[model samples]
Target: MRKIYVIGIGAGDPDHLTLQAAKAIGRTNVFFLIDKGEAKQSLVDLRERIIRAYSHPHKRIVEGRDPDRDRTPADYTGTIADWRHRRSQVFEELISEHLREDEIGAFLVWGDPSLYDSTIAILDEILERGEATFEYEVIPGISSVSALAAKHRVGLNRVGQPFQITTGRRLAEGWPEGVDDVVVMLDAQQAFTAHPEAEIYWGAYVSTEDELLASGRVADVAEEIVKTRAEARERHGWIMDTYLLRRRPTTDD
Candidate 1:
């Protein structure tokens, strides 16, 4: 039977690769990657660095074109479902055409496969379709959530309080009910301002050479963050950021 390994390469930094992740890469017979286009060459280069640092010199590397999706779809949920299915088809074709029986192929995910990444979902769909058969394992790696908090030297959760992790779209509706601590990821719009009273610890390109950090009351640092974020994104063609927002700790607590 063919085998696959879904390995997290970590956020924007080759050094974030764990020993287990390295070992998994070293043992891979083939490394499968999604070509995210030229705008994200930095992402590709970082993935290359990981392979160079570990894998066998002659090991095979396969690149599959990542499916493109409509950024402004009329039906968001429907569009996402269609996009995911498209991606599953692409992955299935890659495995069926390129990977051989008994050979181990691996996909290097951006962060932990179990997080917001879609590799696991696509792979599961491929298996479910029965067009191919393969065994796979998930090797966890450090996520931007961890890297962001680490860079800021802040804890994700406050004492005796539960935190929520959500996206910018959901946050735009309003602050989560009864949640004092919230970690927002994939927020390009700077929605942290919704709670002006909150303190935010934000990081971009975390753990990488272009790392940027900002922490202060949202009202104080929001504009700076927006400016910095825009500059970074316009300069690099993309950005991966995460933030932890907490209702400012008061002496009364």
Candidate 2:
């Protein structure tokens, strides 16, 4: 039997790599890094830099490409299912080719794998289909939300108050009801505009050398965020950003 370690690399910063994560990298016999095409080269480069910094002498690096999805399709769920299946296939192929008995293979995930990442899920699906079998372990890392909160010097949730974490798509479709604070990620649509009345603490390229930080009333800064995000994405060729929104308390409430 083989062992597979799914380690979180944190949010784009080398410093965020936990000691355990570094140790995992060193111990693993094979490392698999996913490439999502040129639009996300920064991610690939960051992973490579981390591997070079911490990997053991004998560890093999295997680069894998995730399959592209057809965005023209009207069926969103179907598209995602197909994409996931393709991604699983790619990973399964890599694991089959490189996995050795009693040797550990690892995948370095961005941020925490337990968060929005689907890598573990896809791997599980492959196992369910009986395509692969390996003992798996997930090592958590500091999430973007934690980094964002630290940068802003604000608690994610008020004392005794609950908060929610959601994607940009959900914010755009409809703001979740009754949440005081919401952490939003994967925001390509400038979803802050949907919640014009909330206060926002936004950061782009967070924890990186070229980080951009902005905070203000959402309505007041939505346009600025849109413009800044566009410029940053163009300048850097890639950007990974996260933000927090707090619905301001009304005088009546």
Candidate 3:
């Protein structure tokens, strides 16, 4: 059977690769890469470094052009569904054309595959379509959630409080019903600014050479983060950032 390994390579740093993920890289015959474009080529470069240092010379690299989607759209679910369909089509084609029945293929993902990343969802679409017959396994790597917490030297949760993980879009809708400790990812707007009373631990380009980190009461640091984010985005042509927001525990306990 043709086998596929969807490996998580971590957030922006080659060193974030787990040994298990590296071993999977060495075993893969064809590595399928989704090119997200030149602006975010720093990510592709990190993946390349890991692949170069570990994979055997006989291994191959296959590039799949990532389909573009509206970053902010009124029809969020519809936009994503259409985009995922296109991505599944591209991935299915790549797997069918280059992956032989007995050989293995791999997709190196940023952070953990189970996070906000879409490779797993796209692969599920490919499977449901029955265009490619392959066995696959997921290798989890350190997610930005963990990296962010580490960089900020803080735990995700307070004493007995639970933590919430969500996207900036969800955050804009207002805080989740019952959580005071929240980790927000893919937040272009620094949504934490809306809840300035909360303390925030924010980081950008995490674990990379251009890494930037800030922590303080949201009201105190929100403007600085916005400015830093703009400057970093202009300098690198892209930005990947996440933040944790923690408020005083309420009686919901």
Candidate 4:
């Protein structure tokens, strides 16, 4: 049976690559990647640097074009589902053609596979189709959420309290009930701007050289964050950011 490893490369910083991930890279026979086009070439460069630094000298590399999808689709969930299906097809084809029965292959994931990433799900879909058969394992790595909290030097939640992790779209709709602390990711919408009362610990491209961080009362810093985010996105052509929002306790509590 062929074996596959889904390794988390961490949040862009090469030093964030864990020892287990490095060992996995060294043992791999082939590395598979999805090229996200020229606009995000920095991401491609980072992945290449990691592979070259740790992967065995004889390991083969395979690349596939990322499927294009509507960035602002009316049906967001449906659109992403379709895109993931196309990606699974690409990965399935690559595995079938490149991986030998005895060889091991891998997909280097950004952050932990179990987080917001869809690589593990895509691999599962390919397996369910029964077109390719391989047993896989996931190696966890430091996620942007963790990196954000570390960079800001704040706990995700208050003592004995719970915290929620959600997307920017959900946060924009409304703050979640029963939770004072929320971590937002994939927020193209800068949803924190809606709740000006909360304190925001925000960071863009956390752990990388081009990192930018800002934290303060949302009312005071939201404008600055919005401007900084726009400039960074324009400069790099892409950005990956996450922020933690903590709502202050009220007299009722």
lDDT, candidate 2, at 222 = 90
Instruction: Give one digit per residue, the lDDT tens place, for model 3 in 58-114.
Output: 999889899999998999999999999999999999999999989999999889999
In candidate 1, what are the lDDT values of residues 83-152, reduced to their tens digit? 9999898888888888888888999888788888888888888888887999999999899998888888
Total backbone collisions, model 3:
0
Assess the local accuracy of residue 133 in candidate 2 as a C-alpha lDDT between 0 and 100.
85
**lDDT over C-alpha atoms for residue 8 of model 2:** 93
Worst 10 residues of 2 by lDDT: 244-253
Off by over 4 Å in 2: 71-73, 250-253
Error of 1 at 230 (Å): 0.7
lDDT of 4 by residue, 1-253 (tens): 9999999999878999999999999999999988999998788788889999998889999998899999999999999999999999999999999999989999999888899998999999999999899999999999999999999999998877889999999998999988999999999989999999999999999999999999999999999999999999999899999999999854233
Clashing pairs in 4: none
Which consecutive 10 residues in model 4 have the weakest lDDT in total? Answer: 244-253
Query: Candidate 4: deviation at residue 243, Å?
Result: 0.2
TM-score of 2: 0.94
| Selected candidate, larger TM-score, 1 vs 3 | 3
Scored by CA lDDT, what does every candidate get? Answer: 0.87, 0.88, 0.90, 0.93
lDDT of 2 by residue, 1-253 (tens): 8999999998777999999999988888998888888888878889888888898887899988989898556887799899998999999999999988899999999889999898899889988999688989999988888989999999998766778999887888887877778999988888888788899999987788888999999889999999999998898777778999998643223
Stretches off by above 4 angstroms in model 1 are: 249-253
What's the distance in Å from true for residue 124, model 2? 0.4
How many residue pairs clash in model 1?
Answer: 0
- Tell me the TM-score of each prediction against the true structure: 0.96, 0.94, 0.97, 0.98
Candidate 2's displacement at residue 79, Å, is 1.4
